[model samples]
Target: MKKAEDAQRLLRTLSTEMPEGWKKDYAGVRNEYRQAMEDAARQAALEINQTDPEVIEQFKKLRDDLFSSLSNHQARWPVLLLSEQRSVEYRQSVQAFEAKHSEFVRFMRQST
Candidate 1:
């Protein structure tokens, strides 16, 4: 949860500092993520092998948690930007988060 907050903070900072034109790019990327997640959920539904009620409940809880966090970040993206003082740091944070998220999505898709 702490890591998620840290990532959100960095994302807000970067979003504020970004040029106005980049908002369109951001929207595009966000849409891609949305599509990927939708596909992942569909795949998970089709591929989930466990028949036990307990394990299925656990999986649903975990999936809900992940989707909630990601949705929070996406929801906050419309807020205005900050200055460039910490731009480098925030950019690095965003990149790290993106890499981690992409890997998580890939793993989830494969595991499902």
Candidate 2:
């Protein structure tokens, strides 16, 4: 989704010297995601296809994992910005971790 790409850009930007008030903007965006997710869940509940117990169980499992990983994902961003130098090595390491975490998210999305 275009919004997902936009989120990645803003996130990377936040790691590289964010603008004033960006933290509040980031939190708001996060809340928006929660709201959207809730809306999707409501839609799922209404759909006739949502009757399967196994499917519902899988969705619950993924939701738990997603929230747990979100904590680590948020922590990693500030860790990437730890040094004032912002060396290539640090960037590369954080990028690699980000890639792996992104893949984890993709897996979670598919699971749900």
Candidate 3:
């Protein structure tokens, strides 16, 4: 969860503080964010120890949703630095990702 939050912050910084040569910088940020998310997901998998099958399934679904949200946000990166329209779309994608992340966090807290 901390890793995911850090990745989210990194992405927000990348979007808002783009340097002059943004394309090159974006690639590095993108890689970092991807690695962070992967780490977070792995940690989440290891941490979930619910005995109930249904609860386990719920956790799995939430984890999948979180990753799917991250993927959707990542898909917007290339076009995100291109134009105002793309920027708007990118913002929307970020909002969607954050929503999923919040949902995951809430569920995790409840389960724990």
Candidate 4:
């Protein structure tokens, strides 16, 4: 859990960097981040389910919102999209969503 949070932060930092080495992998990073968030959300739900089902149910909505937002922004960047402000914002939003999701999950763990 703590490890995931740390890894997420590192990934977020990476997302903020220029897409030099990853010229064609910017979208891949976003997609992979989305996938990782979904997995984390699922784990969080499972953890919460042990105590209160409804409490964990909220994570699913957050997860859905994250994916929907990411999907809408996918490949919608300017021409020659080599990672710009738009990508940065989208990545940041995804990071924020994950951070909140992780916080929620951690809180649940503590309470449980």
* Best-fitting candidate, scored by lDDT: 3
How far residue 44's Cα lies from its native spot in candidate 3, in Å, is: 2.1
On residues 1-112, what C-alpha lDDT tens digit does candidate 4 reach at each position? Answer: 4544555565555556754664445445555555665666667666555666666565556556555655655445422563555556665756666656556655656544
On TM-score, the candidate that comes out on top is: 3
TM-score of 1: 0.55
Mind giving the per-residue lDDT tens digits that candidate 1 earns over 1-112?
2333344444454466686665565565555655655566666666666775765665566566556656654454332342345456445645655655555555455556
C-alpha lDDT values of all predictions: 0.55, 0.54, 0.71, 0.56
Give stretches of model 3 more than 4 Å off: 76-87, 109-112
User: Model 2, range 13-107, lDDT digits (tens) per residue?
Assistant: 76566677666666666555445544544444454245678766666565455545555555654443444576776676556655644554454
For each candidate, how many residue pairs have backbone atoms clashing (under 3 Å)? 2, 0, 0, 0
Off by over 4 Å in 4: 1-16, 50-53, 78-112
Sliding window of 10 residues with minimal summed lDDT for model 1: 77-86
Error of 4 at 26 (Å): 2.3
**C-alpha lDDT of candidate 2 relative to the true structure:** 0.54
**Candidates 3 and 4: which is better by lDDT?**
3
Model 4 pairs in collision? none
Query: What does candidate 3's lDDT look like per residue over 1-112, in tens digits?
Result: 5665676676666567665776566677667766776776666666777567887899889989988877766665663455434556666777888888788878776776
Error of 1 at 87 (Å): 8.5
Clashing pairs in 3: none
